[model samples]
Target chain A: MLEVRDIHTYYGDSYILQGVSLRVEAGQVVALLGRNGAGKTTTINSIVGLVPPRRGEIVFKGETITRAPPHHIARLGMGLVPQGRRLFPNLTVEENITLAARTGNGSARWTLDAVYALFPRLKERAHNRASQLSGGEQQMVAIARALMTNPDLLLLDEPSEGLAPLLVREIGRVLADLKAQGLSFLLVEQNLHMATAVADWVYVMNKGQIVFEGTPQELLGNEEIKHRYLGV
Target chain B: METLIIQLLNGLVFSMLLFTMAAGLSLIFGQMDVINLAHGSFYLLGGYIGLTMVRRLGSFWLALVVAPLVVGALGLALEYFFLRRLYGRHRHLDQVLFTFGLALIAADLIRWNWGAYVESVPPPELLSGQIPVFTVQFPVYRLSLIAVGVTLALGLGLLLERTRIGAIIRAGVADAEMVSALGIDIHKVFAGVFALGVALAALAGVLGAPVLNLYPGLDFEILILTLVVVVVGGLGTLRGAFFGSLLIGMADTFGKAFLPEFALFLIFAVMAVVLLLRPSGLFGLEGT
Candidate 1:
């Protein structure tokens, strides 16, 4: 479980996440929905300590990782599939995954074989350079790269941003399967359908604040909140 | 015809020497985005230290082993104390200016301690003689440099491409923040790379001493030559550095041998042509 309390983040003088807060229970798929420039990615960056929040605290499982460095935060059992997939273009698919592989807390549940089984397409192109992969394949590589760390929680930032509809559904199915395997994750998304489909609970963000928080059914029924905040 | 062959071999020797120096510059530039003008200072410092070791200990081999280690420790200290303060994409100009200042200081220190006299190390006794090649006698040491350069290129290439550390370094070069978020301490990687880059330069210094010699402004000369190689090869890739060094080294050697008056312009001419054809250098990626 993770708890973010009144976190304020900034990029120089321009305030990004203005006292935003959210949470994810263990083994739950929590979706944070927001429109363009709604501080979704900034929130993720804050939690990962890439841009540490200037205010408030982030409690991951039990440790306070508010001002820790990015790598230290990661070692404290967090994995990030950063926005844009950020794969080392020159590295092979296998190298990209294996580079991030760490044996943390002695729970090596996610190995190369396990992730390959989850996304068999990656195995077929294991030795190919990451730059040569398709968008969907790159996304899979990114996800696989995160899983290789065997972290307690995964933070996914806009995993379906540029994928085709069919591939988006495939990602949704993968998320569902990951959730079934008891993987806790906080997914940032603009895709309402995919978020609502896999997420156990949902938080809608707008202008750097959490504007709505409720069950998926509660969110689906609220047309005004959906239309105004998410622009759906 | 024999003169041409000798000059060609001479070009090969200089190319290998340039590769040894440029590879470090390229790695530092590629991995940390730090344009360390002090790189040349490290080379000069290494050479001066090697000169002292060879004079006092009477062993070129001992100096070869010690100079790099000493310079590498200095590099580690430089990264920790000074260079660490000037990191980030926007602070590149600051890093460059800071390193230039460091180079000036290093040059002065070397002058004060070692004096301004030109000094050269003798080749090891085993490699002291000459071998006949195509009716021309070549220094065995010079010929051995070609072997040394090739071995270093292969060793460095293997260490970077085949090992996990190499994969991490390549990843860091591509996207350091993403690498850290994956549980890697990128700062440690940065420090290690900075040390390694300068150490390689020091190794080149010791290796190149017998031929190039040590003097007051050789640091700047070596620095300029290295910058040309990195620019010609492209930044961030070892292959680029290797090929670029060869191109620039051969051009410089042949130019000096054939058209001595235009020797300085020839290397630049090669660089200009390469840039016109591929703006990113021979092995550099686009937008690097």
Candidate 2:
């Protein structure tokens, strides 16, 4: 479980996240829906300590990690699938996964074998450089890489950004399967349909604050609110 | 024919020395993005330390082993005290200014301790004799220097290309923040790499002492030449360093043999041509 309470983050003099609060219970898929510049990516970044909140409290599991560095936060079981997938272009698929591997996550830890089983396309291209992989394959490698860290909470920033429709559906299936395996995910997405397909609890963010929190069904039934807040 | 053969051998020997001298400089710049203008000073310090060790222990082998460690420790100290604070500042000017100043202080210290004298330590006894190559005799010491440098280059090539740590270093070169995000202590990697670079510089000093000789102003000369090597080879690649050193070494050696008046200008001329042709040097990533 992760809880971010009333956090304000900034980039120099420009204020970004303004007193935003959200939470995800254990093993739940929490989709943060927002338009561009709505501070969804900034929210995830603040949680992972890439951009430390100017004033806020972030609790992971139980302990406060608001002031911890990014590496320390990563070590404490927060895996990030950065925007653009950010795979080391020069590294082979295996090398990219192994670099992010953290041992002793628990009995159900995700090993290279486990990840390879999940994404067989990556295994075929194990020796190939990440740059050689297609976009969908690169996104798979990114998720597998984060999984290799055996993180309790995975933060994804815009997973469906540049994917084809078929690939987006495939990614949704993967997330749904992972949720069934008791994994937690905080997905930052602009695609309303993909967010609704996988997420249990939906939170709509507007101008750096969470404006709506409801079940996916509740969100889908409401059109006026979606048109006003999400421009959908 | 004999003169040509002799010059060819000399050029090869000098090329290898240049490779060894420039390797560490290129590596530190590649990994930490630090110019380390004080690297030549580290080389001078190593030679002086090796000379002192040989005089005291009466053993060239022991001096070779011990001197680099002392110089490497000094390098570690430099990183810990000075360079550690400057990571991610995006201003390399501070590093250039600080290290250039350090090089000056190092020269004064050497002059104060060694009395401004030019000295050349004798090669180890096994390498003291001459070996006939083709139509001419070459000093065994120079031949050994080539062997040492080539062996080092091969070893370094393996280290960067094949191993896991090498993969990490290569990845770090591409994106250091991602490397840190993967839970790696990137600062530790930087410190160790800086120390390794320092050790290589000291090794060059100890091994090259007989060939290059030792003096206070030697630092500036070597530093400028090494800068030429890094710039001409490409700023952040081993291939650039190797090829750059090779070209400069051959040019310097052959220029002296055939046209003594143009020897000094030949190195810069080669650099000018390479830059005009490639802009990023011989091995630099294009448009980088």
Candidate 3:
């Protein structure tokens, strides 16, 4: 449901993403796997117009949205659980979620009640400021905040980056549940196990370019590809 | 005993006025990280505009309402045309330089129009006399100013604490990028906030003009006081501004009243103590 084609992004004068391209179909979890400095986050940011691509196009549900502002892109049913879970440190858990609430596509599936049901710990700590929460709890709040937008395409950048194993597993379960609900996702992950477990398709990126694309089973079976590119 | 009581009332009145001017300055700095050297220009603009309105209509209340709107529009224009382009550039010095230039320009404009002479506005009829309290008589207008300042403070506190827009503003202050990503048009938010802050300063100026007097150089005087307030209150805390104003206000008032020769030293002395103790102001958050 989302297409990013030959996008170039820059941070100051340094070109971070060099003609990177990817696609995610409806009701699919597509993994963009890469090592450090692979431009995965840059690709995601370019799509959301956080770091607008200087070249190429981004299309979402048949509309070219390359030049749209970040808020406008967000309003167009794309949610980003940004790396580091950049929650408002002073806002309460509930405020963080409700602040992003929008009926972008007239879908009410991801309301406050729905989010609370997904993370009951958030409901219990709804009144506590985001900084008061543990890292895992903060991640949950960040996810729930993005979900409140009821986005058509959710971009998750390193959701499991700093979480414990148990929290990572819980995050995996949440992604599985979200996949069952027919939400498309472009997940940028460093954890191969979690990516393989949740993602239907995989694209390995190296040196600002996508080098491999296949079904998760195909990539798992290709030992040479994993050893050379992913070191797994 | 009468002199002490009169000085006590004077301290309260001055503290309240300081609160009015400092609160908006604190919010703008805290939320946008904009130093806004032009803030005092808005205050000066308010007094000049209010002077004109009061002269034409002979009504303090009318000037109070009209002056802020004019100064606020000016602030909105400044944000849209100038300050919006400087975001996230570590352009703090550039912002200071630009706004300091703007302050100088504003002062020049006021001078060109009103000249350098100090002009005074008399209190309205109801507030023209003094009210006796215990053996001291206080100017009814000063007491009225204290009442208005307190009311505005409470109203602002409620607006920040209880309203959804206030919640968004507070959130924006903490992480503006996150707020923008959450479907908020931060450009619009920033403009509106800057305008609101300017309007508050204007309102304080109009309310205070009768006491402080109107002159072109008034901007520099109030600007220094505002810097002191912001520094002592920490950068972004509203509560800090309030308490800091009170501390400075009381110090300035009682020091001048009791020890006229050392009153200026008292203001700096209080700031020194605060710096030695907290370094971030009395209520400001550290590393903000």
Candidate 4:
């Protein structure tokens, strides 16, 4: 479980997250929906310690992790699939996945075999350079790289960005399967349909603040909230 | 043919020495993006340390081991105290200025301790004789230098390209933030690699002491040579450093043998042309 409490984050004097709060229980898939500049990435970044919150506390599995360094937080069982799929372009696919491979978190760990099983295409291109892979394949490698860490909680920032609609559906299905297997995710997305399809609880963010929190059906049913906040 | 062979051997000997120094400088440059102007100072300091150890212990082997370790410890302290603070906060000319200051101080310290007079260490008795090579004879120590340099090149190449830690370092070289996000303590890697880089430079300094003699201005002399080698090789990888050292070494050697007057100018001209053609240098990756 992860708890981010009223965290105000800033990039220099420009305030990004003005008192944002959220929570994800174990095994829950929480989606944050907003248009551009909604501070979704900043929230995930704050939690990951890349951009530490200017003022707030983040607790991961009952421990305060707001001020921990990014690497330390990652070592504490929190994984981040960062935006832009920052893969080592020159490293082979196998090297990319295994370079960050930590010992698994729980009893049933995610191994290279498990990740390969999830994305068979990755196994086929094991020796190819990461830059040679297609966007969808690169996205899969990103997810697999995170899973290699065996994180108790995974934060995905725009996993479906720049993907085809079919690829987006495939990503959603991959998340659905992972959710069934009891992986907690804090997903930041612009796609409402995909967000709703996979997320258990949805939070609508606007202007660096969380404005609405409800179930998937509740979020879809409320057109006023959707139109006003998420710009749907 | 005999004259050509002699010049080529001379070039190879000098190339090995330059490679030993440039390999470390290139790796440190790639990893930290810090132009450690003080790097050659490590060589000067290590030569003095080796001189002292060789005299007191009466063993070239012991001096060889001890001098680099002493210089490496000093380098580690320098990183922890001074250079460590500069990371992220200081990127450009400030780092150069700081390391440049260190180089100055190191030169002064060497002068103060060892005096301004040039000093030299004799090659070990076992390697003091000459060995026949084709038509001419070569000093056993010079051949030893070639052997040492070749072994180091292979060993370092394997360690960087084959191991998991090497994979992490190579990846970090490509993208640092992602490596950190993967739970790698990148700062530690920087420190470790920096230390190794300095240690190797010091080791080369100790090894080359007999070949080039020990002097206060030696730091500045080799610093220029190392910088030229790193630039000509490329910027990021060990392979680049090795090739760069060879190219520059051969150019300098043959240039000197045939055209002693214009050798330096010609070498610079060749280097400028190489950069103009391939800005990344031979075997170097882009973006430093």
Candidate 5:
């Protein structure tokens, strides 16, 4: 479980997230839906300690981790599939996965073998450099690399951003399978259909603030909310 | 035929030495994206420390073994106290200014301690004499230098290609943020890498002092050569550094031997062609 309480984040005196707050329960997939420039990436970055929040607190499993460094936060069982699939271009697929292969919680739920099983294409191109892979394959490698750490909570920022339709559907299936395995997630997604299909709870963000919170059914029924905020 | 063979051997020796210096500089630049003007100062430091050891203990081998360790520790301290704060801030001008100042300071310190006079290291007695190779007499010391340089290069390559830490370093060069996010403390990695780079430069200096001669101004000359190597080999690729060094060394050696008046111009010409054609050096990765 993760709790971000009234956090304010900034980028060199320009305010990005003003008193933003959200939470995700254990074994739940919570969607943070927002349009462009809604501070979604900033929020995710703050939680991961890549961009430390200037004010308020971020707690994970009852411990305040606001001031922790990015590596320390990662070591605390949080895996981040960062936006834009920031894979090591020169490294092989296998090397990329193994680099982050840490059982932070001392559990071997997602080992290299398990990740290979999840994405067999990764095994096929395990020796190929990441730059040689297609966009979808690169995304899979990024996800598998994060999962190799066996994180308690996975943060996926736009997993379907640049994928084809089939790949997007496949990503949704992978999320569903991971959800079945009782792994918690904070997914920042732009695709409403994919988010609704996979997420149990939804939080819509606009202008660095959360404006709506409800179940998938409630969100689907609220046409006015979707149009006004998400522009769906 | 004998003249050609001698020149080729000389080229190989010079290439190996250049590789020893440039490889570390290239890796550090690639991984941290820092233009370390202070790199050659470490090289000078190594030579000075080795000279001291040789003087005190009268042992060439002891100086060779100990000087790099001392210079490497110094490098670690420098990175921790100074270069660590300048990461990810687009402060390259600041980096160059700070490192240039550091280089000047290091040179001044050396000059203050050793005086401004140039010093020469005598080769070990066992390696002092000449040996006939293919009917041409070549100094045993030059041969030893070639052997040591080649051995170090091969050893370093193995350590990089076949180790976990090397993989992490290579990955860090490609994307440092991703490496940091993977739960490896990048600051510690950066410090270790900076020290490692400086150590390589130091080792090259100690090994090379017998042939190159050591003085306060030695840093500037070697720094220019290292820059050429970095540019020709591509910015961040170790293999690029090796190839670039070989090209430069061959050009410098052969040009000086056969065409003395045109050698310097020829070196820059090679660099210009490489830049115009590939711009990334022969072995460097594209777009990085």
Candidate 6:
């Protein structure tokens, strides 16, 4: 489980997350939805300790990690799939995935075989450079790279960005499957259908604050809240 | 024809020496994004240490092994205590200024300790003699430098491209943040890379001592040469550094042999041509 308590994050003097709070229980798929500049990525960054919050505390599994470095946070069983699918462009797909393979204290649930089984296309292009992959394939690589870390909690920032609608649906299905297998994740997204279809609890963000917290059906039912905050 | 062959052999020897020096500089830059202007100082320091080891222990081989270890330890300390503080995109100028200052201080200290006299280490007895190369007698030690350089190039290439740690370093070079986010301690990787880079420079210093003799201002001369190789090859890639060193080394050797007056100018000319054609050097990724 992960919890963020009223964290105020800033990029220099420009305040991004002003009093943002959220929580995700174990095995829950929590989606944070907002339009551009709604501070979704910043929230993920804050949680992963890329840009630590100046105020408030983040508790991951029981420990306070608001001021921890990104690597330390990662070692504590948290993986982040960043916004841009920042794969090492020159590295092969296998190298990219293998680079993130860590055998922490856990029994190592995710292996190269498991990742390849999840995305068979990646295996076909195992030796190909990351830059040579399609957007959807790169997204799969990004997700696979994170999963290789064997994270207890995965934080994804815009996993569906720039992918085709069909690819988005496929990603949504993958997330649903992963949730079924008991992986906790906080997904930041602009895609309403993907988020609603996959997420167990949805938190709609607006201006760096959580505006709505409800089930996916509740979020879809409330048209005013969806249109005002998420631009859905 | 004999003179041309001799010069070509000389160029090859010098090219290998330059490769040994440039490999470290390129890797350090590639991994940490820190332009260590003090690289040549590390080389000179290694040479001086090697000089002492060779003289005291009466063993060139011993110096070759010991100098890198000493310089590498110093590099590790420098990274941990000083270099780690100035790591960031906006703090690049600070890194340059700091390393430049270290170079100046090192130059003064080396002079203060070793004095301003030109000192050269004799090649080990086994590698001291000369062998015929196309009607010209080339020193065996110099010829051996080519082998050493090639072996080092292959070793470093394998280390960077094949191994797990190498994968991590390559990944770090591309996206350090993501590497760290994968539960890797990237700062340690940076520190290790810095040590390796400086150690290579030191190794080059000891290796080049016989042919390039240590004297006043040689650090800057070697520094400039290493910089040229790195820039001409492109930045942050081993292939770039290796090929760049060869190109610059040959150009300088041939230029000095034929047109001594314009020798330095010729190296820059090759660099200018390379840049004009491919701004990122031979193997550099775009926008790097």
TM-score against native, each model: 0.99, 0.93, 0.96, 0.95, 0.97, 0.99
Error of 5 at A153 (Å): 0.4
Model 5 segments beyond 4 Å from truth?
A: none
Residue B249 CA displacement from its true place in model 5, Å: 1.2
Inter-residue clash pairs, candidate 6: none
lDDT of each: 0.93, 0.86, 0.87, 0.89, 0.89, 0.92
TM-score of candidate 6 against the unseen true structure? 0.99
Candidate 4 structure quality by residue, lDDT tens digits, B144-251? 998999999999988888899888878877877778888988888888888888898889888998988998898988888889899988886888889888888899
Q: Residue A210 deviation, candidate 6, in Å? A: 1.7
Question: How would the candidate models be sorted by DockQ, starting from the highest?
Answer: 1, 6, 5, 4, 3, 2
Error of 2 at B54 (Å): 1.6
Candidate with the larger DockQ of 3 and 4: 4
Please give the range of 10 consecutive residues that has the lowest summed lDDT in model 6 chain A: A98-107
Which candidate has the top score in DockQ?
Answer: 1
lDDT of 6 by residue, A64-128 (tens): 99999988899899988999999999899999998878877758989999999999999999999
Error of 6 at A148 (Å): 1.0
Across A48-84, the per-residue lDDT of candidate 2 in tens digits comes to: 8878899989999898999887778888888899888
- Please write out the lDDT profile of model 5 over residues B1-288, one tens digit for every residue: 888989988987888878888988898898899989988898999999999999999998998888888888988998888888888757899899999999999999999998898899998888998999988999899988778777777787787767878889889888887788888898888898888889888988888899888998999888888889889998777778878988998998899999999998999999999989997777778886
Pairs of residues clashing in candidate 4: none
TM-score of chain A of 1: 0.98
What's the CA RMSD for each of the models?
0.9, 2.3, 1.8, 1.9, 1.4, 1.0
DockQ (C-alpha) of model 1?
Answer: 0.93
